[model samples]
Structures are given as C-alpha cells and as structure tokens.
Target: MKKLPLIMMGLLIFSLVPYVESASVGKASIDQVMLSLGESVTFGDYKIQFADIDQAWTQALIKVYAKDGSLVTSKVLPTGYSLSVPDNDNPLFYVRLAWILRSNQKILISLESELELVEGDVQINKNDAYNLPYKFNDVVIPAIKVKVTNTYENKANVRIVLPYETITATIFEGDHYAVPYKLTSDFQYFPYLYLYLKNATTSYAVFDVYLPKYPTTVFQLGEGGAGGTTPSAPGAEPTELVYNDIMYEGENLIIDINGTEYALGLNTVGYYSSFTLFDKDNNPLKSFEVKKGTGYELSEAPLVVELINYESEYKRAYLRVYAPRGTEVAPIVRDPKIEVSVSTSSTELLLNDELLVFINVENSGRGRADNVNVVASIPTGFELGSEIGTWSLDTLNPFTEMPVLVYLLKPTQVGKYELGPVVVKYYDERGIEREVDSGNPLSITVYAIPKLSVTGEAFNGTWGTYVHTQEKT
Candidate 1:
C-alpha cells in the first residue's frame, strides 16, 4: 500500500510538470506612472514593453512577452472556439478598459509577469549568424529564434533555408521580422543558415543572398531568374497556417473583435432605420437625417452602448454602436403617435374686442412624450398678450390631449389679418423631438364698434320745457 501511494504521487507530479510554469512570478507596482516611451522591464517569465503614446499626454501600451502561445484567464487548454476572453486574471491577464471619457488626469498601472531565469540572455549580431545562447540543466536547448531585418528599400519576400527547413517571411520595408524554428535533435554544435530575398510573386532574384557558406536557406513560388535553391533547413515541416500577409474586411461598419467581425448599430427597419443617432463620444448631431451609411466612432475596441432616445418613436435600447454592417435592429414604429391641432374662439374679431386662441395637442402614438411645447406666432396686425402666445407642458401620455388657450388683444387697425400656423413640438415614441404644423393661418376681420344714438322724443307731453338732459351719451 505504501509503495502504491508513492507511485501515484510520482505520476501526479510528473503530469503537472509539463504544464507547470517554468518561469518565476514577479511584479512591480508603483503609485506613480511613467509617461516616457520605449521603456521596458523584465520579470519572471515575462517582459513588458511600452511604446510612445500619441493620442494621450501620458499613456502606454503594455505588451506582454509571449511567443507562439497566449496567456489565458485560467490554466485551461486553448479552445479557439470562444471569442471572448474571460474577464479573469490567472494564467491570463486583463487590461483595464474604461468608459468613453477624456480628462487631463494621469493613470497608473502595475504590470506583472512570469519570466524564466536563464544563465545567459538571447542575442544577435550584424552581418553574422544568430547567437542565441540558452541554458538548460544538463539537457539540450530544444528551440531557437532568429529575426532577420530588411536592408532594402522595398519589402521583399524573404525565405530562410536551413538544414531540412524552409520558411518564407513578409516584413515591412527596412524592418525586422522574427521566426521561431525548432530543432529535431539536441543542439550539439552551431549549424550554418542561409537567407534569400526576392520578388514575392515573380520569384525573380531582386538581390543575391549573401550565404556565408554556413547555414542553408528557403524556397518560393517563382524560381526563374532567382538564386539557386540551397539545401532546405533541417527538420522543416510544411505549415497549413497562413503567414506573410494579413487579411482585412471591407467597410461594412463592422468591428473587428480579434479576427472575426461583430456587427452592430443597425435594425430591421430597412428604410425606416433613419433616426438621429449619437455616438458614445460625440453629442447630438446637427443633422436629423438617418441613413444606412451614416456612422460615428465610438471606440477602436469591441464595446456596446446603452442608448436612450430623448423624443424619438423608438423605445430606449442598447446598441452595439459603430459603423453598421448589413445586420440591423428592429424597425422603428411610433407606438404613441403625437398630433397637434389649433383653433380660434372666433374667426372674426370686432374692433376693441379680445381674441381667444385654443390649441389641442395629443399624443396618438403608443409611447409617452416627455417634452411638449406649443407656440403661436402672432399675426402682424395683432399685439401679443402676457402669455406671449406660448404654452408648454412637461409630459403627455399616449392617447391623451392637452388644450391651451392664449388671449390676444389690441389689433392694430386690422382689415384682414392672417395669424400664423401654431407649432407644437414634442418627442415621439422614440424620444425624438419633432414639431408638427397645426392649423393653417387664421383669417380675421376687424370692423369698428357701432355707435348708437337715441333721442327721447317723449320730451314731454308734460314738462316740454323741462331741462332736456340731452348730453353727449
């Protein structure tokens, strides 16, 4: 029984050893933030590299040093199916992503890493073979990496041909690209390597590879006029994975989450998708027009926004905002259609008589209205009263109406005056502010007040000479 337990313990540790991290855990946390660029630090099995930030006064892009593998949220196997990285930190790391706001304040971050301790560091020299010195405990170093630089003006297709190995490279002009190559056998001695650069498609030798009669090099598509092929690198394996060129999607307003596209900010309303849309950053736009091609930048990353309409026909909804792809959201339907009507107490106004104006505004749609204001433009002949011909309401429920009355008096000698159409502005079901034209211009006639003169002919059957109080009545 004792022997069996010991055997089991040995097997358990052995299994864990392969996945067990070979590096040391290290972290450097500070209250202050560094604003300089090109700063770097190494700890445990990780190296953090920071580049200059242009968009912000003090910002840095922290890149973790991981070659050929990724740091996941947990110690689980890489299942490339799920697009989301769990918002966890363990074997994986999570960077702090924040809201859509800009300020002059500074931010501080503490970077942590796991780096493998080595007796010596990796190195490469100019015009010579790579000198990668790796140390292992009494065993052989299994892998080596070399990054070749482009010394020419145009970006040429580079191929590394070595012992039983073949690798093609696509690097920016005058920039260096790294390649990791594994060895079949343990490192016994230094091996020779060869490099070749040529036109990518034509296989035409733009320049002859300067092989130091040491390591051999790579192969390509076109062989005509190109340098002779040396022996392939050792233990070379053909790869199904794509390298060299990067693929980009078209302008369908799609946000690229990793390599896949997650489309947003559209609905099934087809032609009715038109509404005043605001981005996560910018405020309400001037143009009220909405169309398929319209877009605003919310962020360069994958994020969703909660949108609340001020006074539109559509209800408040969460939208994955960005340039929209072909996919769309549900159509816009005015649940509570709003309508406004206007009328006058009397079409004709007698001279020295006041006029009463009545306006009936209703919410006919299914949704509610928050802001509703009615204003009447005074006719040229009439003077405005204390109300200023304006009435405002805070809210109007669907299928409800509010009546308003405005009194106007002192018509400036009106012959025939036409009052302007009343304007009713309110938010529709979507919280979109929209104004409706009420009744047409009102026409009124102002005639002088009639004068009545009465003479008492009964001046008296009696007191004829009585003092006739005939005064100006």
Candidate 2:
C-alpha cells in the first residue's frame, strides 16, 4: 500500500483515554515562634500571686469573690484553723491542691491582716458588728534589669515598663525604676511586670525593653576623599582624631575592607567600608599604603603647592611654576611671560626732501625679541641719504632695550607721507608668532623750488650803448 501524505497521516491518528485521575496538592509548615519582648520590663510588688491549689497542699491561702459584692471568702482564712471544740479536728478546707490560680479572679490571701475582725468576742458589739468592708493596701516590687549581649564595647541605658491592672504601663531607663527578668522562666509566676505607679492604688505594667535615645553619627562618602579618620590613641590621651567626654562623639574610625574594632559595651556587626578616605589637608598627597590594622598617621594640615619665582625671560617670557612646599612633587610653570614692542615712527614722511629727522625705537620692557628692521618713508622729489649704522638685535631680556637705525629718504610728495608703520613681529617662548605695527602718517611741507635770476646790469654788448639784458624766459 502507498504511504499516505504527512497531513493525511496526522489527521488519521486515533487515541484512547487512560483510566486514571491525577492528584496534586500544596502543603505548608509553620516555624517556631521567636517573639522578643524587646529589652525592658516593669513589674510591681504585691502583684497577684498564683497558687496551684490542686498541686500543692497548704498552698498560699487564697480567697475568691465575685465582682457583684456577692458573698465570698472575706479573707484567705488559712487552713489549720481550730474548730469550736477545743483542739478538735483540723479545719476542713473546701479548696483542693494543684489548682491553677488567677489574679483577676477577685481572690485575696487569708494571711493578710485586713480580714481581722475588730471584736474579739463572739457576740457582735454595737460598734464592731456594723463596721464597713475592709480595705487592703497595694504591693510594691523592685525594677527589673536587662543586660545586652554584643561583640563591641558599648554603654547604654536600657528601658523597661511593667503591666498593672488599675494603671497603664510606664517607661523606665537606667536608674529609672526599671525591672529585671531572667531568661530561664517565661514569667509564669508573675504574668505581668510593673512599669510604674499611677497613684497610691494603681500601677502601670509592661514586659518589653526600650533603647529610644541613642547617639547619632554623621559622615561623608566617596573617592574625592572624606574628612579625617584618625582615631585617638587608646587610653586617656587627647588627639585631634579622637574626641572624648563629648556628647555623641565616637572614635573617628578609618575602616578599610573588613577592618574591625572592639566596641565598649555592645557587639556590632561591621559595615562594608565606602572607599572614601579623609583628606587631612586640603592639598593632594602622593600615593601611599594604608594598612587596615594600623591607623593612618596623617599630617594635621593640608598639602600646599606654591610658586617660588620665575627666572627665564626670552626662551620664555613669563616664568612661574608650582611646587609642593615640603613634598617631592614640582610646581608647574604654565603660561608666564608676555612679549611687547612699540614703533615710534610714522609710515609716511612729512618732511622736505633729504630732511633728517631723528626717531627712537625701543623694546621698552623685559621680554625676549628678535628680527628687528627699520625703514624711512620718502616723499615725492626726495632722494636717499647716507645709511645710518644697523641696529643690533642680539637679544632683549626682560626690562632691556634695543635700537634700530635708518637715514632719511627724500619726500616725493608735499602732502602727508608715511615714514614707517614700523612692524615688529616675533615668536614667544612657545614658538607662537605675534606681530604689532605702530605709526601715524607724518606730514611734510615742501616749498616750491627757489628761482635765482639777474635783474639789471650795465653791459657792453654788440648792440652798443643799450642796457645789456639777456632775458631768457
């Protein structure tokens, strides 16, 4: 038989359902309860004490009563009382032993003196028979103590409050009426701890410890470095790093990765350090190793970079560099010197032809300069005169002067003419070329060429006796 097509084969598949039922369910489990009653406790004395009547015979005699002024035992009249028959049988106690007792059950112990009758005789006297109900005084208990367990040394005033019936719980700290407890028991004997006394008859109670008022610390973070972290030396010495007897002043700890210190009273888990180191001086210091166990011995002040003095002028005009006062690093002489030149000549000569005019050119200040040149402007109808000696431009240090020489050239024009807009351009120590030109055009007054002629003279000429006049126009 020919094979069916793939699509046809898939369409022809047949399946049977399995006879089965799948089952699944989610489950959960509870962990042990770990309730910490914080760190404070308050308990009052004369708090209601419990007696297991069913468990212990001759238990602390207890009297039970109802709140509605019903008839209950007036006082916890203890067993072993004498009967009417002198030394007869022992007084029978309706209560049994091993019975769990409760405080709020309106129970009063029989041993208390408040239950005593005023009349000693069996006959009721007029004054003692109709007497009012008895009143009982309250009990007072001592404060509880709590000691915290931690790895570091720390001093703290722990607080705790006690619970009471007539009054709400109260707060207490070190020397502040705090209560104490032992971890060995769950306080079954005394369910409530007294916190404070509201009045003569009421008391406040609690079971937790408090640490509300603790010291606060402030610090900066990161790479630019931080404030100082020098710790004061151990013991009783004063240091810039450590401040004692100051409120909230902790040892300025410089902690590296995983560094540790033992605190005074409490144990503290170490926090990972932020890489910021404190800069003792505002100045930058060279790289050095900072050991973890050993505290850094920082300079009390910041590093300083100063400019001593500048010496070179030409190769460089401004001379200023920085150097650390007492460190190995040298100071930098950024852009120090400035070069300048002034030309005291005009571009156009305003003088008569061949007139000689004296001009002065100078560098004027302290700066290196070179490539000096000078030229004189000649007006129309002027001619070149003798050349002056060449100006020497060997070198011009700071505050030095250089001169150039140029003889006058005749002016060709009668109007204003420029002698020299003397252009002085030179390279600074940085090898950067700079130029400066200075000149106001010079004005010249040219007079017309003078004419010399003979006016008259008696002369013997070929034309005899006539005044000899040779007039050539």
Candidate 3:
C-alpha cells in the first residue's frame, strides 16, 4: 500500500466527482409528505413543481422549475437532502419523499408532480423563548431543533450545512421543527452545522454548534496511584480519543501501515467491530484480541477485521487493539493506478476532412475496475456531435487495458487543432473509485483545399527549353 500525502489524498478524492447529469424520471418517491408530484402549487412569491420521481438511489439529478416556467436549478440532491433557494421571497417548492437505492446514485420518487419544494402550515407557541443558535450535546447522533423567526407563511426555505454535507428543504412550520441526524463512522472530521433562511437571493445563515458527547462511566479499576479507566467528565465534553478509528462489520477493508505505532481502543458507546489483519506484502498477521477468541479477524499482516458489536450483551464493553510492534492503521480506500493515452487518426488534415480520436486506458493495479468511461475534449471550433461524447467499457480486469474510439469529428475551418486529454473514471471491485487524465492533447494541422483553375507557361529543364501554352483553359 503506497502512502499518499494528506493533502494529495484530499485533492484526489475531490477530483473524482463527475459532473451531474440530467435527472430522468423515477418510480418511487418519499411518502409521509402529503402532495402529488407535478401538481403546481403556489406559496410565497412563485410557483414550483417537478416531474414525478420514480427512481431511488444515493444521488439524484433534479431539475427545479419556478412559476415562470424557467429552470430554477439542476441540482444533484441526495437522500435526506433539501436545498433552499436563497434570497428569494417566494418559497413555493416541495420535494416528495424518495426511496433511496444502492450506490446512493439514484432515487425512487413517491409522488407524481415535477420535483418541487415543500410548503405547508406550521404553528409555533408564542410563549416559548426561542434561541438564536441551538446547541446539540452530541453531533454524531443527536436530535436537532430549529427555531426561526415567526413567519405568517407556513412553509419557508431552509438550508442546512453539516460538517460533511449540505441540504436544503422546505420546512413545514409547526410548534417547533426538529430533526435528528445519524453520523456515519466513515470519515473523520469535526462537526460544524450551518443553517440558513433562504428567501430569493437573500439568505440568513443560521447559527449552530456541536458539543462533544460525554462518556457514561460504567465503573472504575486500579485504585489510587495505580491504574484505572480514564477519568470521566460527567458534564464536560470528552476530548478526542486516540483510538477513535472505527471499522464496521462485514467490510472487506484495506489497512495501511502508518508510522511505527498503532493502538486501538473501544468506548462505552460502541458498535461491533471485527476484522482480519494482513500486510501490504500480503503477509498474514493477527492481533492479540483474536488470539484470546473474543473477536473476529480474517487474515494476518494487513488483516480484514469485521466489527460487529460489543464484546458482551450488557450494552457496555471495552476492548483495545494495538498493532503489531511496527505498524499503524489507516483506512482502506480504492487506490487505482490507471494511465490514459490518446492518439488521433492523422497528424494532418485538409479542411472538412473527417478525423477520428483514439483513447487507451491501462490498469496497472491489482483491483478489478468497472464502469470505465472515457470522454474526449475536442478543440474549440471543431464540428462535434453528441456521438463525440462518452464511451465506456463494462469492465477492465487487473493488468489489462482497453481502447476506445472516443470521438469522430470533421474540421469545418482550416487551422491547427488539438483533441485529447481524455478523462477516465472507473470503480474498483470494493467500490473504490478513481479518475485519471490522459497525456497532452493530440495535435493536427488542417490546410484549406486550394480551389483554382490555372493556365500558365510550362518549362522543361531536362530539355533546356521553356514553352508557353496560350489557350490552356
């Protein structure tokens, strides 16, 4: 497992995201909300609606339309995500309940309307003392309560930004609006929540903060100056722990070896985690917990550990794992080694000449890649059609390569041109995704075809004589 610098890893992850496509219709939508899809509903200042969403996946491309029949925005909305139109006084929109599908790539629409924003009636008690920014005890899994200035309109645009994600929704005003969030144990970062009141282009950002979860002390051991469970802050937030890395159960994970030190710890608030260990060289190894027959481990060295639940059923158990003497633990993500090369049919061409571009994708890694796509960038001013778009391969096995005719175009003007720097995106067996850019763009020169009729004098050097031809036309 080659190590990547922290900054490089972040940028690599960011670069893998592709441009969103237009959302097609879906079958299943989120229920629980009472509204039909495509039904034009009016609210504050504008009318909004959407086509019935009949699909369900992790991500959905939704195109929103305002009352003017103009596109509001084509947004990639995820499950549990709501986007508030900022700075607009009119808040006519509603997103029906959607059923999420695998890969989180698609969604099932519930109602029949074009995707619209939600609007409805909500009543709040006047006696309640509203807080400016509500504070949550634990962001990882805590209930959130939102308090907004009382508005005559029942539904208002709400925009929220979590540490890892952002969402916009039409808040159905009520006595009080409260939502609960369950943070995944996937990525590590601090929690920061931002909410906004979106009305047209003017948005009033909400204020919110997270207070770390305090541990519930079960008992104490090693009295006096000896040893015992770490001191507990019953009322204060717990400091970030060193052994906070969590691996879920039934995951085929890759473990990267960090510096020379590795340690694992379990908390009272915990889930089951068991895994096998293995090294980068495919070496097998085991952790001490597995030797005692209390946990799960699939292999050695760079082990595959399955984290299930607590050690016992008491709702409280503690365990710690320390990596073998010389290695630290890191997450297993898809690391694809893909190379892209491109070539054009000809280095030179005449105006209006048809040209073809070829792209080659080489997989020099161990993982099996799927959904390999290639897209070419044709130089500006070239005549291109939809056919000069994306090409794909169902799969590219490890140590193999694939080639595609990514683009075909005809030059309409005479000049130098470039075509290439094809972009490649693919997913490995474990759902590790990767993307790559091809080498420099391919270049071609185009010369305008000479269109002329000539009648001139002809000369023969071999004969040492010059002869002029009149009436050569």
**Tens-digit lDDT track of model 3 for 1-473:** 12333554354344323211125221111122212333332222333333334233233344455557677644344433333331123311234323232321223322221221122222233222223233222212223333333332333444344434545555432212222232223112122222222321122222222222211111122123211122233211111121223332323333234432222322233443333344444443443343211223223322222222343432323332322223334443334578888776788988867877667778876456888887666687587743532266657765677744556777878888777677888887778777889867777888989999866565443333566554566
Off by over 4 Å in 3: 1-334, 385-390, 393-395, 428-433, 457-473
Q: What is the TM-score of each candidate against the true structure?
A: 0.26, 0.24, 0.29
lDDT of each: 0.37, 0.26, 0.40
On TM-score, the candidate that comes out on top is: 3
Which has the better TM-score: candidate 1, or candidate 2?
1
Going through the candidates in the order shown, the clash numbers are 50, 87, 83
Against the hidden true structure, what lDDT does model 1 obtain? Answer: 0.37
lDDT of 1 by residue, 178-255 (tens): 333332231111122222233222222232222111111111111232111111332111101111111111111233
Model 3 lDDT vs. the true structure? 0.40
Off by over 4 Å in 2: 1-353, 364-366, 372-381, 391-394, 411-416, 452-473
How good is model 3 by TM-score? 0.29
